[model samples]
Target: MELGSDLNAGEITIAQYLKDVGYQTGMSGKWHIGKEPKAAGFDFSVFFKSNGTYYGRQINDEGIVRKVEEHCDLYCAERSVDFIKEAVKKEAPFFLFHNTQLPHMNGDLIWDARKETKERYEVSEMPVAANRLDDLSGKPEYLKSVRNLSQAKVYGYPDEQAIQKHTRDYYAVITEMDEYLGLLFQTIEDLGLKENTYVFFMSDNGWMLGEHGFTSKVLPYRPSTRVPLFVIGPNLKPLDLDQMVVNIDIAPTILEMAGVLLPDNLHGKSLLPLLKQETVNWRSSFVYEGLGTYGGALPNLTVINKDFRYIETFENGTLEKVIFQEFYDQNNDALEVNNLMGSAAVKSKVGEAQKLINAHKNRILKQ
Candidate 1:
């Protein structure tokens, strides 16, 4: 589906399910999925369309469009806190989708981070990505062409200075976002809701910060696909997990936590067992697909595990006509600088990966 387009009416959202089960739902910031948050089951909404400007912009306050002069993140945080406060006063279980637009580029190579936050970092001290300088000659032809022609090449192929500036602004905006989030966290704590509330932090997608000479996502590489997932709540121990998990798992997990029955149509398993640190059978590998959102990126399907990532690029978004393949031994080549597709040792593994991919396709079709 396109950005700003309505989601399929036949599909049910987690918000709709929760609202049916007696939860007050509110959303703030970045509601790009067409119509308004109310249509998606949010009872209270203060949202903006698409990627909003960091400065003055229009916000939809429960169907009223008004100009917000403050940074969008701050406005979102304040509104989220207010939602929580109101929900608490009503003695209702609440779900606040407090989204933000921080760190995402406002325009081509333009970052609108707060001046104080941006000044905290010195450009000279910013560490460049290890693969930023790669020429992409050994990689896919599509990536090479993208590096040469995309808007990322406007200031030339991301020299140390350019990469440093990007990193600095990126880090600064994230820090500013964290500062704003602290207010909501403090409000929750002050209201004695920290023990009862689950705070899940995650990103929709990871960005390519000069990795493989690319600046955007939509590639089937670690830098473009991998993102952080953090879950904080009552009785959850602090520990790291190596098991593979997908974004789909989040919905089932939340439903399980809220004592709702898992829908048969749900494609993901509940992560409650994993969160409790119980030994459980988990996925060893999962399929990752990219539909070429950025310029020159081919539609690709990939199987990624802790040990390796195998990608098959297609001729177009229809995903027909396999044009190129890439295999990376992630154990040793974390940066994916070397392609292992031609190696004799990985020949058998390639067949195994294809089998896994086909199995995933069948499962998706069944769903």
Candidate 2:
């Protein structure tokens, strides 16, 4: 139930709906769905107090701090397993959003991996992923700040070795999570409810893996918005939705799957038909936004269609003039190494995208 990309307020927090619908909702791992999990309707949560860290996790049991410990993911998985077992005994359907913070960075696991990988890349040598903003040192009032590890000096800058080590460690965590997901699947099967239960596995946002000379998950780049989303359940037919699907659509899709009527106010349309391998008459483009300037305020907007993507960054203080524009033709430069925003033909596409963005924004705000 990593409902929407932004773990922030008012962005289709599905956990709230899960709890409201009488589903025993339990969250293990990052509960970045605003400052209060209990208020958001999570029954039990083992969340991190802050971002970037694995050793010594903070737990909140319905709003109260319960405990903290190292090896957070392992503990979280144990608790989740227990919750599942209990839910089975109670004869109730359970919704567990196991959002892992592990591949996120600044954790004991990272430190361990650094040592394990024998410092392959210098800390400074590695650059942020393309989707993240760089150089936040000047703006004190910025929403977020991006900082490379202090240990970068050891890597002799260009931290290739460090980056490689981090990548390996991140994959290791994913492997561990995959194993847990496998267990979860097994548990569902063992309980004879595999056919009925719906499970979605996806990343909240795409991570910067040394793409575009930047790192992090804030930029309006493809790596950030293009998260991997997959579903395993009874109703959903296996099919890849190659066309653009925004994060906002997820809420309606889940609601539709559970036989719940989608709210008319939601900005997204139900993706149930698409999941069933049915042709859906939907929009060709998706609108995207992320943490604003500083780290969270530098307003960025994007329109991604099946064939092309256009992104615009507004000046920090003034949201009027476009500071930068990037255009990528998926058919031609699939890697997105080249920018076509400057071309005359590309400008026409951007012009169209602007109208699409305006329409989406108006529709959502009106709702």
Candidate 3:
């Protein structure tokens, strides 16, 4: 799991599993694991390295590396549409892993949003986060170091004007990405595949647009940890479910949908039952672990449930020394502005959160 390292040979990726089950697999956009998508079981791919440039980035089309003139998100979408058309021509089931880099910061700010899209939003109209100027007094001390090292520092601590501009550009890039997604969705409907194809809309992580005076995703705050996850497919109810889920669930869900057996080693449960509106027991709590990828933030394990979130910060990557702890009542403080770890109200629940964290660690150790 080192940076730029190849995916382990034994890892059974979703693409590999789908291809094994006779489905055509294609990938477009970021493939930073190492080597290329082909080694990871993608039959066809147009990919680039980590956080590719929005314009004129080098792309590897099936093995031919070349610079593309158009925006990377748009290019990736078009290539994915091409893959879908090819698969339809062959009358084959296909899985296209299309990744987009839109809305992600390019350097200290968002800079590559299309001109027309960028103009749609006025900076003066953008709303800044309430905690944009937080001094980090109530939170973990490491967050102060993170704020100093993060993009907010590069942007000169982000005054009101700077924050508004960043937010405006963020919205613009997202709108651009939405238009690109429309192209894919329209293609699917036009090809008569709308009834069968499953389109999952999700993000790898959420960004901090001046949230708690931070500008990146390394912190374990709600703004950084929470992300959108929705599935579109045939016969699935449109209603929302309140149960919590994690990214690991994606693999098993897709496997079940394809009628492929779920591997016993997979830790996440399939969400197909929930999607079908079936009554079933679901997870009440989920754990979030951050390994301090940015070096300024401390490693931490957080237990998040409907009632509260408990975070235990460690001293280093070893995760041995518990240096700090935080507890927040989710129902009362949805924004997680208040830390209640030292309060008597959460003393009893602290043990419960620790037990959950221990259970997760034991499960990982067994795996």
* Model 2, span 185-240: residue lDDT tens: 77778878877788877777786555543445766667767889887888566667
Query: For residues 172-270, what per-residue lDDT tens digits would candidate 3 score against the true structure?
Result: 888988998888999999999989999998998887877777786867888888899989988987898788999989889999999999989888999
The candidate, 1 or 2, that scores higher on TM-score is 1
Model 3 lDDT, residue 38, Cα: 86
- Residue 225's lDDT within candidate 2 is 73
Worst 10 residues of 3 by lDDT: 103-112
Task: Name the runs in model 3 displaced over 4 angstroms.
Answer: 107-109, 147-150, 156-158, 363-367
- TM-score per prediction, in order, is 0.95, 0.79, 0.95
Whole-model lDDT for model 3 versus the true structure? 0.84
